[model samples]
Target: MTLKATKTWFLRLLPVVLFFICYYCSQIYFDSYGSSGKSPKTTVSLCDINSSQRKWSSLHLNTSRHPELFLKLEDFFWREHLSNHSLPYGIKGSELLLLKVLAVVTSYSMPGNVESSLDCRTCVVIGNSFTVKNSSLGEIINKYNVVIRLNDAPVRGFEEDVGNKTTLRLFYPESASYNPGKHNDPDTLLVLVPFKQQDLLWLKEILYNEKRVRKGFWKPPPQIWLGRFSQIRVLDPYFLHLTASNLLKIPLNPRRQQKPVHPTTGILAVFVALNYCDVVHLAGFGYPENRNQQQPIHYYGQDTMKSMKNSFHDLNLEARVLKRLEEQGVILHLHS
Candidate 1:
């Protein structure tokens, strides 16, 4: 071949070689710094895929009945500047850390139409109330399409009353189950209810195993979380905000002399289920009518109502809300 012909071939392939090299380098850079740097634009598109798959029934369409349930990826960055004195139920200084967590955790959405009836999606929120001990409600609870349980509740020995299936188990870092496998099914989505900035930090550390934080929690959190990263979900603070602000009519940030109030995990679970499921049910959700009586608050533990005196939640107010909901047929309260 002529020398000029060889030079022509080299010129033709130069652009192709450069293109491949650039592509490889970009992939490496993104894989390393994607979560730490600016939040990904793909977050919005990912949530949009399943955001509006189901339409609210006529009952839920009533303005008074429904509230925005889940927080989209856009919520973290766009709304960070908003005033959120209610630290536990709002994102303020922890937006970037939360973005990192969101990048790794899975987005939860309802499954696509599997049933013939559109309004057939049923959910049961199982509380830890002691009344459920001998309820024999296990079979009935398992029949629902979604069974949501709260904070570290055991299901192994009490399966006869609480059922074995768990679609979503909502808990905070301190309340997370040590034996997650024994309490939750393999596919159960573990939802985190971040009450403070440290909660988000705990999730990030446990999910990535980057660092261990020993302080900032009311109770010690699990040093080693046994659940899979894919199963972890950050419950949108919007539901907590709604329950506190709208349902309970509590102030987000009260005056210095006023005590701070927040919704309990059980109430938050009900609000979460309301937006996602067509039919919502409650089990094991009432305090003893006679506070003077010596009755345990939870089915599994010996903790009594006296333990609730210094609690951030108002059990009496929450009970009133639940009773109204039951009377309105917004939720079915099951008695075992």
Candidate 2:
């Protein structure tokens, strides 16, 4: 064969070769790091994760926290999404309808295999912060393999900056609302991050009995507003714990009186992409230490501070983690 023919054949076969290479390396990581019970936590730096510094091997591995998975009521609700806090795992909290709802929803899960793919995928995780307001990342943000938005923020008016596309939108019970005015992409995934059992129950009522849950609304207030175009997935509680323990590596200091908070929606979403995608990008996520601390948290809203002052969610710690990951070249961090 001519040299040109050889080059063409090699290029055509390259994807198949890369897939096996990635698969073989992944098995190694799962064996040595996972089953041996060695520390998954690493003080990674950009120098370490950069492909030029090494190879794609740094990106593949068993960042998967555990081999076994759990998805049952008595098992699931016990896992904490809130800061070291758990929900009362019984039906005694003042409603029976809620109990019936759990019995149904708890049976469904996102499934470990559902998010996996053999091809390379890029993901962009969008946070609700003012840093994104005028950064003009909308066009770039929408082009990723997947785009995830936290809670609910407006995309219509801010499309130039925040991007009008959303692949996934995550909502906790308190933050979960069906925005009547915002654009809802029919294919977007509505993921409910269960802070408590009530959040799960509330989601069920809204999606199923839209009218009875709320009166005379054309669509349920914030429930089933997506209609036929969307679906719901609850974040696994165990996965939430792993990001805190492994990635964020929350300080173990006992002298600190306040308990460490659970991972924020933004961080959890980043970890989700890391598990599934070949590369991940984080936009509008830096702390305002260099700017006014009292500025708005989101570009779309002036009703909040640049960074919240609360123990429920440790915004400061999260900033540091993302910075370290960026330095390590694990993620492309867009803080402007």
Candidate 3:
């Protein structure tokens, strides 16, 4: 209970305090410090699809036999598609109506027969991260014809305003499906990105449900958004079932291909837009490094450190692909 006793207690606590400091700093170092030894691929554009218009009826009217649509129609019972609303937000109504209008318009306006058709176009992938905050990247990303967004990362609420040209919502069957009032729309192409084989089976079941699907009794009517929403229209369904570790040619298996795996649902949506559109842009990615000191924003509304640790590898991979595309002169990589 004297000076010597106090000194002994202080000595014991000092090491513990130092250990905690070391751990916290280590996390910060890994999260903020750039990786060394490995070179980063230069981020660039992947394709260019010039914007144009075409006849809506011809483009949208004859969609009766599309295999994907038919297969999906027989699966999920078309529940989500039938209950669409017209609002700019929400999953069921006006949002979907607008998407149908855009799809019909896009379908009607066929691409001209040119070499550019084979080229990937520009697309904007939207995320709810805090990285783009106050950075003024919105105008830059809005240049793309297609804009893909994930859950509700409010543009107005955040610094980078979400553009009006939202083309799709990369959804999954289970917990990832669109929420009723979370500022989503039926017109937002319901891109069901399954992470497993079971997920796909579940989606198929939903599309085929008669009571759920508005017109599941027969083929979905042409020009109606219901069929397309229920149908899987994105890339290879199996591709979504794989993770970045397997897709990006990472060394999960020593004998597998070294090429990068396909992008995640969010990234794939951007690529799909690139495949069909002309220009692409990226926004709301990475971390601000000083997020805690700033306003309430999140890279994904999750713990920043945790999210970064999980996504760092994938983001690095995506950057590599973008850089490669840039090198090929597929598209421009704008930094803001």
Clashing pairs in 2: 45-328, 46-327, 46-328, 129-297, 129-298, 130-297, 130-298, 178-222, 295-306
The lDDT per prediction is: 0.76, 0.60, 0.43
Query: Can you write out model 2's per-residue Cα lDDT over 55-108, one digit (the tens) per residue?
Result: 234534335324222234454434333334343212223234444544555334
- Candidates' TM-scores? 0.76, 0.63, 0.46
Residue by residue across 1-336, what tens digits does model 1's lDDT show? Answer: 999999999999999999999999999888776555333222211222122333223234333433334445666653633555445767767778888887777664432332234544677899999989899988778877779999999899999898898988999988988768888888787888989988889888887888788899888999898988767777777677767877788988789999888899999998888776666788999998655557788989788878777888888899998887776767777766
Off by over 4 Å in 3: 1-122, 137-143, 151-156, 174-181, 204-235, 238-247, 251-263, 287-300, 308-313, 333-336
Model 2 regions lying over 4 Å from their true place: 1-118, 208-230, 251-257, 290-293
> Is 2 or 3 the stronger prediction by TM-score?
2
Q: Rank the candidates by lDDT, best first.
A: 1, 2, 3
lDDT measured at residue 215 in model 3 versus the true structure, 0 to 100: 36
Clashes of each: 0, 9, 46
Instruction: Write down the TM-score for model 2.
Output: 0.63
